[model samples]
Target: MSINIINRSGHPLPAYQTAHAAGMDVYAHLPAEPVTLGPLQRALIPTGLFLEIPEGYEAQVRPRSGLAYRHGIGIVNSPGTIDADYRGELKVLLVNLSDTDFVVQDGERIAQLVVARHERVAWQAAEELSETQRGAGGYGSTGTK
Candidate 1:
């Protein structure tokens, strides 16, 4: 499925690097000055891009593994959803989890955008939910070594 996009960043459009890559890398559309994030600081970085996702589909913003692993940088709300009806600029909520400062540069790869199809569920209220062998078991109920 093709998506309609408006890119005002003057940078290349987000594209998948590999054939089977599920997400496309998104870049930062910052000004000349670099933005600094102190330890445990968070910032909303813009992409200067607007997308028109098709109905029944959504765009998800996720953190890049390299940034999270090497610089301790990640999206505060990983897998943030961009509704199909939203028509605003795409922004990333980035947070620095390290003790040092991190700099954000213009056109820098900040996050990944994954477009996925989702289903809507209707309420089917029932008196009681069915029971199972592991019913009501949650939060490490399965156990770990």
Candidate 2:
């Protein structure tokens, strides 16, 4: 499926791709220097682009595994939900967990976007409902190991 991308700035932005695949597209800023994240620091990094997501679908923002494994830098909200009705700029919230500083280049592939389906449930008031064997048992109640 093709998603519409809008580069609000005059410069060009890169595209998205899977890690196993080479030549994945990435968007970058023109004159701004790369972003550096200090230990225990958090920042909202802008994507320099906007999206026009189609209705009945949502875009999820996720982190790049390489960045997380190598630099201890990852998106605070893994698989962040971007509602279909949201028409604002696409930004990423990154957090640095390592002791050293992490740098984010202008064109770096900081995150990935996945489009998926969502459901909206209707609210109802009921005194009782059907029962199951695991009813009301949560957390580790099922089993261990």
Tell me, by TM-score, which candidate is best. 1
TM-score of every model versus the real structure: 0.96, 0.81
User: Which residue ranges in model 1 land beyond 4 Å of their true spot?
Assistant: none
Task: Please give the lDDT score at residue 9 for candidate 2.
Answer: 51
For model 2, the superposed segments whose C-alpha errors exceed 4 Å read 8-30
Q: List the lowest-lDDT window of 10 residues for candidate 1.
A: 136-145
CA lDDT, candidate 1, residue 27: 93
- lDDT scores of the candidates, listed in order: 0.95, 0.74
Candidate 2 to truth, TM: 0.81
For all candidates, the clash counts are 0, 3
Q: How much lDDT does candidate 1 score?
A: 0.95
